[model samples]
Target: MEFHSNSTVFHCDVVGSDAHTTVLLQEAVDALAVKPGGTYVDGTFGRGGHSRLILERLEKTGRLIALDRDPAALAVAQAIDDRRFSVSHNSFSKIQEVLGQFHVDRVDGILLDLGVSSPQLEDASRGFSFRLDGLLDMRMDMSQGQTAAEWLASASEAHLEEVLRNYGEERFAKQIARAIVAARARQPMVTTHQLATLVATIVHARGRENKQNPATRTFQAIRIYLNQELENLSLALPQCVQMLNPGGRLVVISFHSLEDRIVKRFMRQLASSDGMPRKLPLRANEVRLLSRQTLRLVGKAIRPGANEVESNPRARSAVMRVAERINRT
Candidate 1:
């Protein structure tokens, strides 16, 4: 089946026995330019795919700190008994704090692989998959925060429409929001199937030709919003930059356009020269001096190959961007 054509169909079949095939795994680690004795941070630490590879490249003196907001992921990280590696149950947004606790101020490289992990998606109780009949909870850290069901139960129709439009980019956001409100009036939406059914019914009525599930966008938007995924990414990017040593690398693997856009824009903004008036009376050398940038874009954005995507449809939308810190006087 052409699972990549539809987000729902793609995710539904990969179940209990399946493992997350880290997209662009070697590419991301190689971009880090790992030094055997250097310090590195795996900011997302989703199942230790990248972390284990990093450890392999690290020498006895090399250190790796892995962080994740999800407790389940942290539990898996705890099994690593390496003296050079440590796991923290914290979001990457707190990278600075995590470093402080370890008495470290800078790292040689930092990698953040964004989006939901395979374990989270396949575990029906997490409510990350639309195909799963589970509670509507979508928190990356299930220990805290409001579940999707709780948020949807009280969000205004206008807010719902806005989330669907802006976060999900759903063309039928208004219709879906209206349908959700109407349906909720009859009863609370407490399960994944209920919400998915509601959205599919509304989208199906529109007679769209796309094979993608109608609920895909809505589910994505809710998960993003509830987890403050974009907000956390925004917060973490600057910290990653600040925590890097001169020549340090920042590698980000984003799974969707929204995440990729933010990563692209942030890296570009840092790489760009300071904006000066075109008519400034300074000499060319002065202009160049004033335009010193903090970051250097390492390379072009990368995508998974057809073979990788064929084996793991979830990698279809993956994009990896790399940047290096420029030494400042």
Candidate 2:
């Protein structure tokens, strides 16, 4: 379990064999329109799913620089021995800085596969899934940041309610937050089972609309809040755009509605020129320049097909968006 990411590269045999199937794997890489000698970025190198396929498409001259917050993912990324491929242990939000570290000013393409990976969810030790019981620690990057358990222990009931309401979109946030406060007063909420069972009892009595565990929203809320998932996505999107070469692609596959909204709005806004009409006489080139449109939308948002969803239910919620950087100059 102790996978140190330093001067050594450990070849993990099971890294690619994990149960977590990369959702929209082919679709994502294809959207990149990989050029043989172009450089690319895989913002979230979860289990090296996209990274492996991307490397396959690249020629020896093509370079791919990947970034991930998870230590386990960094270890898995090391398994790739190609000289053209390199990975940095960091969040995608720091993509600009990561590029600096590699002495890369621009890239031909960038792919960001957001949300909790299957390995992170399946590994109970990581505490992503409410269905499985483990430590309440839900830090995406185990190396740093406050654990979910620690945050829950100190967070005010009001703060917890706000997180549940905003991040989870849970309707019963207030009641659940109040109950957590009451329960924690008697005993600290330290484990996944404790929090799950507590939320379930509260939700089961009031609402029974879905088959999913009643604690599902609370768990998601806590994970997203503690890990700053939405915040990171907001920060990374602009950097992804800034780092891409003209005619390069930016592909993002988001699993959460909030994440998808940010991607959708950002892409749409960039692809449009805000419909700015010239009040004064201006040439077509000048109008185009004044418009400030930086990207062209690729097809429409893509979702996993029914067959793929059937095989991997997690893929059901995936939404993939693509846009190509336009030559503004």
Candidate 3:
């Protein structure tokens, strides 16, 4: 169904004090070079931290479309009364279809604040954090798919091992997977603390260098696997490129190396022009650029400054990368 900017509504966060500070806020927004009357997208609205700012920068006619799979995130978006802003409750991977529904053929820029948001992690009911003792339900979109607990119940040992290694990049993935299988056999792994304790028992990393909890990687791996985060990101990149208007920018903030690598490779591959068909030599003016070479790499991968990281620990691992669409005249 088509949702117009004026017709769409969002719920704003009332108690924003505890909200996770949006990392690299100015840098990511500036990368867009947002024009007053241009259209933009916040691919991961997360509590509308970036979306609210984007709306502020836009002119009265300028439009901003924000998307989030989490109902809680979308609820946070419902409080904005501006006619220029619209929020959609769906995965960013469905960019093409969502844009189509809005009658938006292309946008001037797109921002993706990827990974778990603070509210999702802090809210015990959502089951996104290892620090909380909630059910193992890590579905980004609670309305659909298998919960982390459900997946753990039936997933094969090999599959679980692969997810931990591939998504979390945990060195002790094999031992952790074995531990999970063994523990589940004794009793259905239900609460966050139960799983965390079990994983900690198997993973014996010693010393003061363990800055993060032992079960952090295991929970992350399960969340990513259950929600298909990497797969969704891979699917969304090409669509993001395609959705950009000529000269439009794509800004992405990835919290982990795995997600960052995928964005980097996707942008690099699209920016290169190595696969064009060979033809009779022609003048530079006569030669045409490959359609996929529509993007040009922006500045180097950006990281949060020490001050920002100190204020918001969540910013510590965030990495932002940007690219711009080259006019294909």
Candidate 4:
């Protein structure tokens, strides 16, 4: 229940060569405006790519706290021997709770890189990619919950269609779900390739796209639903804003439109005073106190540069947004 920093990480990518390349590395770190002696949080530690960078910007007096849900990331975090840094094994949605456990009241900044990491895609056993043949297990934390295979085995055709449509935005969700139901009656939905092939069959016949894998949206849909990624993000944003010190930054890097939509709306809502009640003809100071903004939108959404996208194609979809906490004095 009380895991130390060295124990794990938040949902994020891998480190080292052949692992995840941290997206917006310089831009994200720079947005944080790291103060050598201030405290900060890397909400999604992944493989410590961002965490490591944050630590480098910190002095011995400064502190960095990190979180990740994947145990694999926990192992990577263990290698960090710095005394000023600590990590936790938990979802980013639990940021407030984790900070409490760490005895930290507020932080100067928080950075969240949302979406699948390259290590997850490359690891066949994790079942994140259709290109890789492995067990159909896409649980972000393999130890915690149901795998994609298990869900597919038990989920009804209608429910499967809903997930595909809502999460993946697949146009032919209904047909694909029907095919899955038929296929499962004959054999178990046990492997990534099996499901990928099945989905591709349906997609190829009706919803084919040449540039992308036919089953790409299907895989993404299942993973998002099963992992409850969007829900976690929704829960985490308010907490991130609440925990920031005045002028502290909240940086989020989202990989898909859905995730970005949630982030954008949340940031915009808090940054605008119109979201508050304004009926009372109260005094200026009183109105200010009652309807003060909690966040101020920073620069425009940042995307990976052309060179970065070319070198790491996965970074192409990334969109980073920044918001700074407002001092309500």
The lDDT, on a scale of 0 to 1, for candidate 1 is 0.87
Q: Per-residue lDDT for 67-112 in model 4, tens only? A: 8988887778766777787778789999999998888999999999
Model 2: CA > 4 A from native: 1-19, 274-289
What is the alpha-carbon lDDT for the whole of candidate 2? Answer: 0.87
Model 4, runs deviating above 4 Å: 1-18, 274-290
Write down the lDDT of every candidate, Cα atoms only.
0.87, 0.87, 0.84, 0.88
All candidates: TM-score: 0.90, 0.92, 0.90, 0.91
lDDT of residue 328 for candidate 4: 44
Give one digit per residue, the lDDT tens place, for model 1 in 196-253.
9988888889987587878999999999999999999999999999899999999999
Q: Lowest-lDDT window of 10 residues in candidate 4?
A: 9-18
lDDT of candidate model 4 versus the reference: 0.88
* Candidate 2: Cα lDDT at 258: 85
Using lDDT, give the best candidate's number.
Answer: 4
Model 1 spans > 4 angstroms off: 1-18, 274-292
**Residue 143 CA displacement from its true place in model 1, Å:** 0.6
lDDT-better candidate, 1 vs 4? 4
lDDT accuracy of residue 234 in candidate 4:
96
Per-residue accuracy of model 3 over 86-175 as CA lDDT, tens digit each: 777788898887888778999999999999988888998888888999998999989989988898899899989999998888888888
